[model samples]
Target chain A: MYLRGYVSSREFFEYNPPQKIQNLAIRDYCSSNKFNYLLSATEYSMKNSYLILDEFLKFRDGSDGLAFYSIFQLPLNFTLRQNIFDKILKKRKQLHFSLENLALKNKNDINLIHNLFFIKQSYQKCLSLTDIKQNLKL
Target chain B: MLNSTVLSKNFLSDGYLKIRPKNQKYLFEIQKIITNKISKTKLSKKNQISFLNNFHKFQNPSNLNDTRLKIYNYINSKSIFSKMYYEIVKEYLDILVGNELVMQNKINLSIQLPNDKSSILPMHSDTWSGDSPFEIVVWIPLVNCFKTKSMFILNPKESKHFYINYKKNSKKHDSKSLFNLYKSKFKWIDIKFGEVLIFNQCLPHGNVENITSETRWSLNCRFKSLFSPYGTKKIGEFFKPINIKPASVIGFNYNDPLAE
Candidate 1:
């Protein structure tokens, strides 16, 4: 019960529900339950979901986490979700391997830490999912 | 990507370039055409400059618009006018804008008489409206323009800084306020009869009321790369391809056989 909110729509339904079904379910759940609390929680989670690759990988790995969780909470179109899923999966593996090697080689470099922080902030502002969807529509 | 480094640097830094027209004959021809249309009589070459400079004396302020429109229509109706206009700035335009270009269909004529508040253009970038940033304007003055009779442009560096801070600054400042704030930073262009000024229309530029004694007579036209990204102005409506390379013509007409 405590981890139900963190479950991906795929695992929660035990079937690959179509995008329409997932969208309808999420909309219905929010309207019927504590709508304000759910909206705030979703907004907070979305603002901090900067590492899209990490989030996508965690969803794939079946992690019951809520700080930065599944894309299922947002009612994204089918093609957009599929496109984002493919891209994030590929980038996740590449970024993780490269960053891990760099961290091991330069453990005490303050410049690397500063660069990482800057990159993270820039990515957060640029890669917001709502913004991405709007751009895609345009 | 430009072949001339100095030209590129000067253009990028100053946001404008004023140079002597490549052919003075074509400029004179254009001036003759304009003078003929405006005066409705054969004016000698010696008096052409004086006549254009003192244009306000010929007509009342109320009839200025009608006279301007009539002259504009008469000049543009002649097929030789656009060709002559293009010839005046062909070299500079080839260096600044690309050789393959889309020229504006109708050239714009501006007649600013002394203390005419109705003819003032507010300070704003063409991009703020529907114009693409890739476009450049060729301004040709029929008479010597100086002091308040000339237009002003914000330098590229300061223009960039203003753009970056636009969201925060625009909340409190309107166009007039912004113009006042950056008045000292603007560069007033001084051009003569035999010269042409090509400027980046993406920068903030406009003119105040002509406070000088002489009237200002100028013609402006826009040109852009034939294949560059277009904003609100579509190809056939506002612009038309003036120079198309042979290869581009072939490519445009090529059709894939598999589609059928």
Candidate 2:
């Protein structure tokens, strides 16, 4: 239920998925992406994370992720996704993070462990192109 | 004196301005006149808000239009009404539009009741329907307006982008769909009784049904420079020169005595 799901399918985009879908997507994305680490870090960290994630979900190119970007590109075709991807990538590189140290400090946090599992599963699903390609036709 | 340069810049950037009126009494008097005209019995100033809010109870859709016209004509007939209207926003109008201006001969009153579908104004630009882009509308509310009771206008920058790509965006969508397309971009104006709004009528602006439990009463009149080029709403016919300067009067009266 990442933000990509909203723009992933033409039906969801046209009919507008219910708030339930939007909420689920946001929670799922936040839980999976270790968003809590950034949220608990500092206000600036939270804002930076939000900016990066929003840009990635909204403007990432099909070449990097899935082919759904090319199909759903019809409605918002004017946006140059590749250019946005490059800009976001440049910004992402500038952003420094010490995941190993942060993980050790927050090792006892149950929520972090749960979120990492969610991330692993969602990432695997994303890597499987057949599942998404089939779902797009529906 | 207000900074004309800053005010002009703000108007040009935002496409609208909400400023406190020069005289609050004028607005109260105008509201009183409207309330008296519409109410079957006399209503005190204290009951003005309730009377306006529950206006739908006074009349149904069948007689709404006739009642509206009656009130419109009566208000325009009062000599103090137009004068008061001008006084409310004359300072801003002088800076944004011009001192030598043509005002709409009749002021327009809009009444939107809660959950009423009959009075909704969908998203549209006045210029799209032959109104002059040179014209600016002076809008004043009789009651506090918020959320659905208030109107929405697309910001200048976003509106420009929408217009530039209109053909591509509109090819697959109708007006309603187009409204949904740029729904997030529209700014809902929250204004109170003592304030006046002078807006660029050329920008896309409109209101949905009054979902709130109140009737919305607002008056609007268009003003433009007297010498500015006219759209379908022409000079002398649709608009009359309200503030003619002395030099313009001399130029208007001057005639060349030739062979005749």
Candidate 3:
């Protein structure tokens, strides 16, 4: 199967792993899974820009599926994320997350991905709450 | 006589140094602070050593991480703690690394309970993550560490060999299997409370499960020369300028008039 790797230049929250490292991981993922790794589409560094992602979706027929560096690289906005999922599912294309070694195969996979996002959001909230409490102490 | 030449040669050859700090005052102070935090009731100076050694009796494996984090957060919050930490090893670092240094922002505390598999650090190099190769880790134990109670570091010569054949070996084995293959090449560190261990972070080093009867308590912090190259962890976010000379201070603020 042909897989187009997606590498994000934009920071996810406070961290952005080096782009070279992300691509290396994607390359390793492709080689291990026996996917013909095509050239990756680098996402724009600008906040809220998904122009490349939109282009990839429009012209995704060239590739069998898309591979992301990580699950967190997906759109944080719930509706935007859902739309991407819907489009991929409707087209019956596979989505691979290299860092997590997971693939979106069915509706259950979408639910699992949603739960992970929820967990991440809650973890961030808890950290912020702790920060606020510490600030109040001062 | 421990001259700079001798010190540098020994450090480079062995990839580590286990020596007593210039003074024990700051070490005693740091130990006292941790003892107060971990102990339910105040302990006298005489019983503190035994209490630390037998810390597993007080903290179980399940709640050990929470306790360790709480203590870590508390210590790192205090400016005095970092100041004292650096003061103890100032002379050694001045000789080994450089006079102008940048220290890691947060000092890490490791608490390994006896027979606890949960807290084991599998064999790996810090450089495998984002740590700079220029950095050196200053590890201070709160109790006597020997055998499985302490950490093991691969000999520098063996480390070079491992890295030379890294691609071939890594393809064949995971970290655990790799450690097993080269287990005999690693030297287990034997350090006491007042002594400090400064080791090359590029060398493969980590601790196994503490099979000894006592628990293990140690603190580790990284330092690199101010002008040295940085890895993924950049200066402002991960490191702070701890020691800077007057010339460097002026250089930082100096703006060239020739530039447009």
Candidate 4:
């Protein structure tokens, strides 16, 4: 539904999607085991459904979600997505958990909320996902 | 992940993208032309700072001096520049800011002398204002940068620590010592005269002193996202980065060409 306006993945099925991105996104979904949206995202035609796929995937979970921003914004790639996703998931969790509970914060708790604080003061210096994985040896 | 079309996803994953473009001659020529311009000048420490401040004042809004921003008009007329260079750079720009990205600035070159190298830029990320994350930084080192010369660091992995490790939480010490740390960690660029080093300016990057016998001449032209603010005029007309965004113009003036 999110990609309805933008051409979904189905449109490009019969023919080669126009942009270099289409081939990549389509192939990416084909390779992954959990790409249910890929069929929906690509409308078997050139529909620019990837943008909505990106928005939808962000709300979704696991690597498929990470793959959206990574593949589409290759230069941005997936590295920055860790922070972006962790924040999204943490917020989602909070919303769900708040219906039942809440969690405490600490110095060691520098995952999503912790990274969130650093967003304002020194956002420019914000590291991409690759840098963190490299530095922390993740 | 193993797509045939993917020509090394490493570049995308790494924030500091290092590409050896097929055509490098234009960069070399641009450096030579800039070197000639430098040789003709006295190149004083004060002059370097004044030039930086002048460029800054022309675009910065806090001051009343948004006048005479003529660097753009000057570069547009340069005989040494080729249309191809513009095309390639513009293509790269589109990659950074999308196909619709506009020219935020023309081009501004700086020859950082030993004396004034320590001032002005204080390890701030290119995103000090509202720089597009997708935007690309085309660093044309007009001068040779090496270990002894003005080289830099990519921090591909540790780069994410930029906001956290260095800015938000890093301890402060003497300015000289901190710069020394920056120098020590820096990977001196063994670049030829024309090689363009493309990186996300969001990555912590800067140059050391021009320890070499020659000077470190460089043109740092910052571009903005397509829909990003450009105040009232076209940014390319300024030839300098619109730091802090217009309205808070960080030293761009169009009415007065020599206001600087």
State the iRMSD of every prediction, in order shown. Answer: 20.2, 33.0, 15.9, 18.3
Candidate 3 positional error at B29, Å: 0.6
Q: Which ten residues in a row have the lowest lDDT in candidate 4 chain A?
A: A94-103
True contacts kept of 4: 0.00
Winner by lDDT between candidate 4 and candidate 2: 2
Q: A39-116 in candidate 4: lDDT tens per residue?
A: 333323333333544554454633322222111221122234345445545644211111001122222332322222
Q: What is the lDDT, from 0 to 100, of the residue B80 in candidate 1?
A: 84
Top candidate on TM-score is 3
Error of 1 at B60 (Å): 0.9
lDDT (10s digit) by residue, model 3, range A12-102: 7546889898899889999978999988899999998988888897654588788888877888776788898888888888789887666
Task: Name the lDDT of candidate 4.
Answer: 0.42
> What tens digits encode model 3's per-residue C-alpha lDDT throughout B1-260?
45889888999999999989877988888888999987888887667789999888877678888899889978987879989999998889999999988787789999888899998899999999988788999999988899999999998999999999999999999988999998999999999989999999999999999999998989999998776656676454466667667785455444559953
RMSD of each: 20.5, 27.8, 16.1, 22.5
- CA lDDT of B138 in candidate 1? 93
CA lDDT of B136 in candidate 4?
60
Q: Tell me the tens digit of each residue's lDDT in model 1 across B1-260.
A: 33467877898999998888658998888889989877867888878999998988877998889889988878867768888888788777788888988787678999999999989999989988989778999999999998789999999999998899889889999988988989999999988999999899999999999999999999999998776666676454466566767776455445559954
Q: Residue B41 of model 3: what lDDT?
A: 84
The lowest-lDDT stretch of 10 consecutive residues in candidate 3 chain B is: B247-256
- List the lowest-lDDT window of 10 residues for candidate 3 chain A: A121-130
How well is each residue in B45-115 modelled by candidate 4, as lDDT tens digits? 33542443233323333321212233333454563463445554554544545444344334555544443
Give DockQ per model, in order: 0.01, 0.01, 0.02, 0.01
